[model samples]
Target: MKTSGLDVAPVNLTHGPACATCNGPTRLTGIEPHPMRPRTDLQTFQCLVCDGVQTAVVSLVH
Candidate 1:
């Protein structure tokens, strides 16, 4: 989510989080590789209430 300039489309990881901007419950929507490092990802979380999406780095599930 923090990373940028992705070469390909991201995959959904199905994780959930609280929206940082709106403080709403969010569902994981998309995922992509970390541009700066390996074995990590930028996971996108979608807020159900505000319909906002935010991305953050998290360990790869598998």
Candidate 2:
């Protein structure tokens, strides 16, 4: 798998979430809107230590 344009950038976080793989800090990579659902959003995170990617589903309410 190639992550050419995934926007994997490292961010400075004083208190960030821990990585599931390496127990390291995670940084927000990108956010993508769901195609089928208007109120749903997908948040992508990358582990700073392990470089693992994780996707989280977020629901927006009015």
Candidate 3:
């Protein structure tokens, strides 16, 4: 599905500790607002291993 130029798809992530700095798996915290879609926020995840962060823009369609 799609909405307002945002594509709705399964947001999956695969990550692991690349080094000793990173401990374990990553975790999702909250959503962030997009520049175009002020009402929408993208899903954000943080890596436990390397403290790396990732964001996935998702469309909330009802």
Which has the greatest TM-score? 2
| Residue ranges of candidate 3 with Cα displaced over 4 Å | 1-24
How do the residues 1-62 of candidate 3 rate in per-residue lDDT, one tens digit apiece? Answer: 64687565654455422323455676666666777985567877787666777676766655
How many clashing residue pairs, candidate 2? 0
Off by over 4 Å in 1: 1-15
lDDT of each: 0.76, 0.74, 0.62
lDDT of 1 by residue, 1-62 (tens): 57667555455444477788788788877768999878899877888888888888976644
Error of 1 at 6 (Å): 25
Per-candidate RMSD, Å: 8.7, 8.9, 7.3
On a 0 to 100 scale, what is the lDDT of residue 57 in model 2? 80
> Whose lDDT is higher: candidate 1's or candidate 2's?
1
Evaluate residue 4 in candidate 3 and report its C-alpha lDDT on the 0 to 100 scale.
83
Ranking by lDDT: 1, 2, 3
Q: Candidate 2's residue-wise lDDT over 1-62, tens digit each?
A: 86678544564443346777888888887778977888788877888888987777877754
Model 2 TM-score is 0.66
Least accurate 10 contiguous residues by lDDT in model 3? 12-21
